[model samples]
Target: MTHSERTSAQSTVDIAALPSVPKVLLHDHLDGGLRPATVLELAGECGYTALPAGTADGLATWFREAADSGSLERYLETFEHTVAVMQTPAGLERVARECAVDLADDGVVYAEVRFAPEQHLDRGLTLDEVVEHVLAGLRSGESQAQASGRRIRVGLLLTAMRHAARSREIAELAVRFRDRGVVGFDIAGAEAGNPPSRHLDAFEYMRDANAHFTIHAGEAFGLPSIHEAIAFCGTDRLGHGVRITDDIDLGPGGEARLGRLANYVRDKRIPLELCPSSNVQTGAVDALENHPFDLLARLRFRVTVNTDNRLMSDTSMSREMARLVETFGYGWPDLERFTINAMKSAFLPFDQRLAIIDDVIKPGYAVVMG
Candidate 1:
């Protein structure tokens, strides 16, 4: 299709006409997406200072506004309040369980939630304890979701703060819990100053142990960081890889032209965890209308949509998908493509991933198509 024709097709798509479709999320942050009510309750129990908002609705709105402040640092500041309440085992378990139930309600069949354990140590909880608590919570939530007739499976990605030197320790922790619930390892923090190279020892340890991991690269930083994450660090997926758009050039008539990096990502079909609203909040991209999702999808990139932080961004997978459809005029087919991208990019073992795709994804999407 011509550029104009494709644009027109996107513009004419309807949102309400879409059916409830199965979704997969691979880049949600655990400490960043807790339910506001859970945060308040945990804060109260832990004697932590509460934010200005008390009720769930008010707290949720407060988080969204803070995350939308158009500065990555400001967007990150919202997590301070959430991490404050999530330092203990009970707090971690409750928040994780609630997240699972919430994601199930949003039609997410599988999700990978990540968080930096180092951040939670301020309350005196050991790293292993933190992981155990979160794991128990996820299992509890999974059971709750299944009991409610909503099937949902969750994997935890233990994140090492990039600015910290504990990535190697976190990597080992992730491998130790691979069977317990943790599926992968990640490095997350301010991306601009601390690049993936800073965590080389951890990446090397993960690589040697044959552990799967993805780095939070190319969100605040640019293509160079993304390239290092893939080439040097050997990431299985990319988190908030919105800046990949920086490498692509658009023609005067709006046709896309890919640079070497963009072409490599597309040809390899590397999974890009693109969070639309979160991208806007971080100033990673100017606007949702200008999000690289439509551009990347059209170019056949392995692009999946996500809510980086549900509470912080006040978003769910359904809401994020709906926003993309409304902004880019996506149809049911487009949504299906994104779901497939996420499933294909999941950190599950090959057999498990295939099972989810064949038994869950295809069948569910078929119903949506019908």
Candidate 2:
């Protein structure tokens, strides 16, 4: 059979069948995935009286709508409430623990959930204390998932807000916790005016220390932002590097010719943490059909799927993969490739990463797809 015929003959998967597919999530937000009910409870616990919605369902709807506002800055305004509620240790631990539990419930076996250590400083928790609380909560969540016969291991990514001046400090915290649950460091926030190169000192410091780091780039901004992140800041991975789509040259019959930048990324296998639903919500693309995900994947650009903000996008790994499978006619082989890509690009040690790919993800998908 011809390649196209073979591809067309692959079975389509139902969305409900995706939850047991053994997903590996590389880019997700801790504050962005808080349960709506938990958000209400935390607001009450912390005396945050300015929530726009008092009811659980209403608040959830409010978050989804606000993130879909088509303005990047406005989309970010929703985080104020989540970060506000996460000031205290109890609040941090609760959210962190729940984040892990929810991902495990969605059949995510390995994940690296990130949040800004600088953003949770409203109530005066030291940076060290903040990291400790998140790590403790993740440990608690891991134990809970294991007890439920669902195996999950979570790692923390300490993020420094790019618009702020704490990247160096956050980098230090990440390196300090390298042997702990902390797996990597990152810088996230608006990408238009604040370039990742602004945190060069932090990136260079991580390089010197041999630490892993990913930079949030090309989500709202364009190719320049991505160029600086890769050429200047030297991130090991890109968080939402979807705008690299602008660099591809599609000539005749949809034959893609890689531009210099695209060639560099594809040649180096720089992992683009492509978060499709979030990209659409934030106006990164016009719609799901217009997304560069299929093109990037076709070109073998080391693309991996992610839910940038689960609550904000109202997405899970299952939902994200289902959307792609339905749109692209991706069957088990495609889903398995994305899962293995994420696992390979994970920030864990080489041995641990390989172990999961072999012992857990491979076996899990084999059973599900069989």
The top-ranked prediction according to lDDT is 2
Model 1 regions more than 4 Å off: 1-19
What TM-score do all the candidates reach, one by one? 0.94, 0.97
Q: Evaluate residue 320 in candidate 2 and report its C-alpha lDDT on the 0 to 100 scale.
A: 94
The number of clashing residue pairs in each candidate reads 0, 0
Q: What would the per-residue lDDT of candidate 2 be over residues 95-177, giving only the tens digit for each residue?
A: 99999899999999999999998888889899999999999999999889889978899999999998999899999999999
Candidate 2 ranges beyond 4 A from true positions:
1-10
lDDT of 1 by residue, 1-370 (tens): 8887665554454454332568899999998888788888888899987577878889888888888888898999898899999888889899899999999988899999999888888878899998999999999999999999999999999999888889999999999999899999999888988989888899999989898999999998999899999888888888988889889999999999899988988898889999999999889988989888888888899999999988888888888988987787777667877888899899888899889888988887666544
Query: Candidates' lDDT values, in order?
Result: 0.88, 0.91
Best by TM-score: 2
RMSD of 2: 2.0
Question: Model 2, residue 357: what's the lDDT?
Answer: 92
Give the local distance difference test score of model 2: 0.91
